[model samples]
Target chain A: MKIALLASTTLDMLPSLADALARAHGLSLEWYVASFGQYEREVLDPASGARQFAPDVVLLSIDADTAARDAKSFRALASQALVSFPTATIFVHNLVLTAPDVLSLLEWNEPESNARMVAQLNLELSGVALGSDRLRVLDLDRVVRSLGIQAVCSPRFSYLGKIPFNKLGLQAIAGQLVTAINAYRGARRKVLVLDLDGTLWGGVLGEDGIEGLRLSNDGEGKAFYDFQQLLLKLWRSGILLTICSKNDEWLGLEAIRTLRFMVLHDEHFAAHRINWEPKATNIAELAEELQLGLDSFVFLDDSAEERALVRAALPEVLTPDLPKDPSEYPTFLMGLNCFETLKLSTEDRGRGALYVQERRRRYEAMGAVSLEEHLESLQTRVRIRAAHPSEFGRVAQLTQRTNQFNTTGIRRTVDELRSLADVDGWQVLVCEASDRFGDYGLVGSALVAQSADGPIVEGFLLSCRVLGRGVEEAFVAATESLVHPGRGVLLRFVSTNRNAVALKKLVELGFVLDEKTGLFGRVAPMELPKWIELETVSL
Target chain B: MPHDNIFPRIQACIVDSLKIEPGRVTQETRQEDLEEWDSIGHLTIVLSVEAEFDASFQMEDIPGMTSVAILTQHVEASGSV
Candidate 1:
């Protein structure tokens, strides 16, 4: 990934140091550092090297004095960068206040004080981040605040090379930025499988019963309470929770249901396997049930032996070594660098309820007489239209993330998607779906192009949440109505390891394989499933 | 291996920061004697020495203290370190 590092000061060593820092954490990023104090020029001039680099991520590390004196310019620069590079996520820095700013205690509280100005600047910077999904604040003030500004700054070096901080301080800044970058790149762990005994609470359920277990707002149980609080936050942030415990089913379920301080109840978990079985087996079963790959799992167990068993059995699953003291659990979990996500969309925040709905939907499937009737019972409504400019962010995210249901398997950045839509004869169809259960927001995308032969489905994909509800067929129908592929609609698809799910029902969808061109084409128009109600959202 | 002797540690800091040969730095060795010891390298050496000895150098003491002996003398005089 290309990363452009533009700073207000002479940070000649930052690019190398930041790249080394990222490499240390298993991320490979190519750095393009602009010349000293050329941040504005680089952003304003379209032909500048940084602009020509066409980076995926940009880190603008502005100096404190510049930030305090004039934040509006920086905000303007950020906006300019947004227009300059549509694909990139711009992370602008918050000014790191040194001792000089707060040295005069009498003037510290003054309205025009440097401290007040920078604080206001940071708030404005945060607003800049909130302005768009692609923009974020690098938040260097957090590091400087934690480690006092006196320790981080070097006046000698500042005078010499226009660089402010020492090597240690620079590394800390780099670490924070890289974490934000990783989160933006969607490298967050997807699931957290936890042990119920001595992990979620202080005591084993079978041994001590629900009354004896420690979990409360205060006292010795506070540790467990705090741990649960963090776990619940992660669940809300879109990490699926599950229990992989070696305990009887009823005992665990009963304790979770009736416990006053149970932050995560049975409804909170997407899946649970509470039988007295090997935890690795239980976790694998939960992964299968959730339809998530094994690699996205992070298993937590209080017992070192259980952690070792899961670690050895399933090397793909991340099993962090447990600290014996339960008091250290919350802080230890806080120290782990696994749970970081950049964008929290409506779909993401409600993902826990969505997956829980999946379990209920499966139960509904079992209750229904047939698959067709089950589909009818779903009552899914799909809104499809030309992809709006505002939705390109989610569309790009879907293209990168949606693998199982994606045909062609080609990932496009927002810049490429915009260019595609701008071309003379192309259409970018976006679909949002809802059912009797809930809304599967912005679940599908299809990129179509007019070729010499006919309309081509350049790339098509649907979110797996809407998979069984006939949303894909409805999305295709909406696309066909727009394209009017007379000879037939042809799709450009090449098989990948994870994309076989996209190709399975192509023939049933009226597409025949042209083995010679390796394309799927249908001479007849696609029929939208009767169960799915399609509406064209005139954009 | 030795305790209460900050001289060798100060020499090591200079060598490490400047990337000089081990024997190139002596008690009397000055910045002019080493090819790698430029003005920027001098500040880098001070920064490393600051980290090594857990001491912050006075800005006035940096420019004149070019020799290894002067650097070591400052470290020894900063009794808390």
Candidate 2:
């Protein structure tokens, strides 16, 4: 990735950022220095012959003190950058406000005062970027605060008595910048492995029982419930949910099934190995069951021992320390940034149900169940809707969050999805699933383009809930029926990390695998299976 | 206290500037530290502090005055905190 740095003043912290960026696998940096005074003419002018090369990422730096005055200028610069390079990711650095002159004006003698100011600036700057989808605001303040804490606590840095965070904080800030860049580039964790006992609920379910659990309608219990709701929301937003608990499996299942006020039911968890086993072993099993790379999992547990066990056993899995207090759970969870989704889709909201359904299939398979019997029992209804203005938001979200089941795993923003909808040759369709249990919401989406050979499936994805229900077959049938009449429509299923389940559907639909690309393609007339019912809505 | 009436004025400053309920802006309330105390809201707090106290703060002071206690102390020391 080619990054261009745009600072209102000379970036005194560029070397640190450059060093960190060099350590990153595929990152190159280029600097563009323009003062706040010359921002209007110099920064806005695209063909001014100043920026000779186009950059993939643009970093805009603003001073906290002057951010108010420079906010409009920065917005304009961002707008210009978007027009110049639509694909480039723009990051706005929270302003750094510190200096002896300014400190004297505030009339405080605290040595860490400057550091506090920088944190405040970054927080404020993040607010500015919240309105624009084209720009992502980096929380430079949090980065600095963590570094300050590290500097104070670390034995190596203890001798540097009261090191002002502003002077040497860039090193840590640069590391965070690289991480954020990588996250934006789609290099992030796929699964969030949660601990059951104190992490998910207030206490162990085995001990607390159904009504005894600390989950309620108000106060601290409410906070835990709210946190569970947030996790459920994240699960729908495409982060695979798994549980690693040291508990009686029967009691855990009973609590999940019987607890009335439980925000996260049994359906919320995709994979779990609830036993009195070491958390590391359970976590490894969960990863294997979900078929996700161990490195793409983030383990969250309130217990220090459990976290340490997972961290020691699987160093690749990110295990962030859970906050001591329950009140800090929201902030601590939000700070993970592991499952930072750039887009939300209709398919995402029903993803939890999909995973639960997939888990049920696995359970049935253990009983030596026939695939046909399971399909027949599903009573699955696949609703195909055209890309309308009302459904645009969810469609775009699905395009962003559908990674494993995604044909190309390419993410698209709302604006890009809108552009695709407007394009003449493209057809975007969203598939919603409803079964015996409940409505699974929008579970699948497909994007196809008119090609000379036939209508080609550009993008195809199904919510993991509707995975084993032969919904993918219905999706292909729906596409073939919509695009071509009385003719065979060619469909392509590209393999991805989480999409191996999808390959089964291609085989079921008579798609032959290509020897060279390993991608399955079929030029046969798509047949809507009798088990799957399709309802088409005009938008 | 020399600035007994200042607390209510500060509260009013926050209520009017931050566009929050007047009841929410007590002397104990922090500026951007509140859940709704976001970027534009933070700027409003800065402007409100400047207007209520009839004092101008350097760009550096904005970051330090996040909490209610800190802002009160700063205002008291400067004859406007």
Candidate 3:
């Protein structure tokens, strides 16, 4: 992706940022340094060859207040850039609140600078991001706070001392900028696998009973409760939630059921293995249940022992350390930008409900004596929908969270997915499953990227709750039928840490395994079983 | 532990702060003789000497703190016992 950066002031920190950007694998950046402090007609020329380079992404680091005051010129500059490079993803940074010394210059005695400045900055940022479908706004406030520095303050600038800006913090921000750029160019992780005990709650369920669990009421358990609520929100935002616990199953269930203080119900977790088994095994089971690969799973655990076990056992799992204190849980979890930094979509809001409905279906299937009886009793409904603006968010969320049944196990951001929806050869399908109990929201998602080989299943995933009821087979059959007619089309099942369960279906579909590579491939005539009804919508 | 030998110890501070080869730090060696002796590096020398000799150098003393001889004098005047 070709990127251009526009700065309003001298980027004293650009050297470090340039270094970081250089290290980024697939990005080519062309920096257009425009210092608002030294605005000149020659420097701001819109018709210059620099603007004609046609960047895929543009960063506007100019201060909002300054831009607003010189709106005509700034807008002209922005307009020229937009017109010259029509499809560029424009990013506008919010103005940082000045320090006390800087604020003291203003006439108002108010502790904070004029609300007008802050409001204008937010307004301009929103305007740009909303005005252009390709534009995005990076929250400078969040970035400043994450750096543990007051963004507005000069911090006693001394040329000899370390640079005024926090080096580590700026590096993180730069890294996120790079991630956002990559996501705009189509690269994002799909699933978030979380550890249960110290990560999700304030205390361990086995050690601290449900009554003793530190979850919020009004104040006492506020931090833990707030963190759970945040996770719930993330799940709804389309990040898949899986549990890998090394605890007694009954105890874990009792805590979720009996703990009045608990905020996350059984439904919040899409797939969980709460046995005393090593976390790696549980994580594997989770991946299998969710139909995701180990490569896509980001594991969070407070215990170093469990984290080490998973890190050693499954090297592909991205394990971010869980901060020791419960208070830092929310901040720590949110800092992991693997799934959070991407644009939010509608599919995300309905994700929690989908997972909940999936769990309800699983509960209903419990203790069914025969496979036929369970299949018949499921009363499952698979709703396939064409890619629509309304379903884009949930579709993006499903793309991110669905793992176990996933074919290639790739994830994409909503923006990227939307762009793909327009591409001629690609087919993006979302599968929402529900039973007699309720709506499963969006239980499955499939993406077929057309290639010379055939319509390759780039992603195939089903919510774990809907796993056992022939949903995987039914969904695959429907997907194949949609793409392949009369003739047999090849299906690829790439083995992953979690999708072992899908291995059976791969073989059952008559896919042959390469003795050396273990990559299963086969050609099978696609047929949806008569009992299952498949509904689909085309874009 | 002779109190008068603090001058040699101050020289040692210069050598460590400047990250120069021990023998390269001479009494007349200017700041340019050492590569790491930038503005921040100079402040580090003052801080290290102050800690080693239990003395404090004034802001004015910081600029004249170019070589080992000048730095040693500043340290001694500040009452390094």
- Candidate 1 per-residue lDDT, tens place, A382-484, comes to 9998887878767877877777888877777665777788855578888988889877688888888888867888889887777756776777767766677
Comparing 1 with 2 on TM-score, the higher-scoring candidate is 1
Every model's DockQ: 0.29, 0.01, 0.09
The docking quality of candidate 3, as DockQ, is: 0.09
lDDT of each: 0.80, 0.65, 0.64
Ranking by TM-score: 1, 3, 2
Ten contiguous residues minimizing lDDT sum, candidate 1 chain A: A480-489
> Highest DockQ, which number?
1
Q: TM-scores of all models? A: 0.86, 0.63, 0.67
Worst 10 residues of 3 chain A by lDDT: A151-160
Q: How high is the TM-score of chain A in each model?
A: 0.91, 0.70, 0.72
After superposition, the stretches of candidate 3 with alpha carbons farther than 4 Å from their true spots are: A12-51, A71-84, A99-114, A127-133, A145-172, A182-221, A240-247, A298-301, A383-386, A389-433, A440-526, A536-539, B1-81
Model 2 chain A worst lDDT run, 10 consecutive residues: A154-163
* lDDT of residue A285 for candidate 2: 85
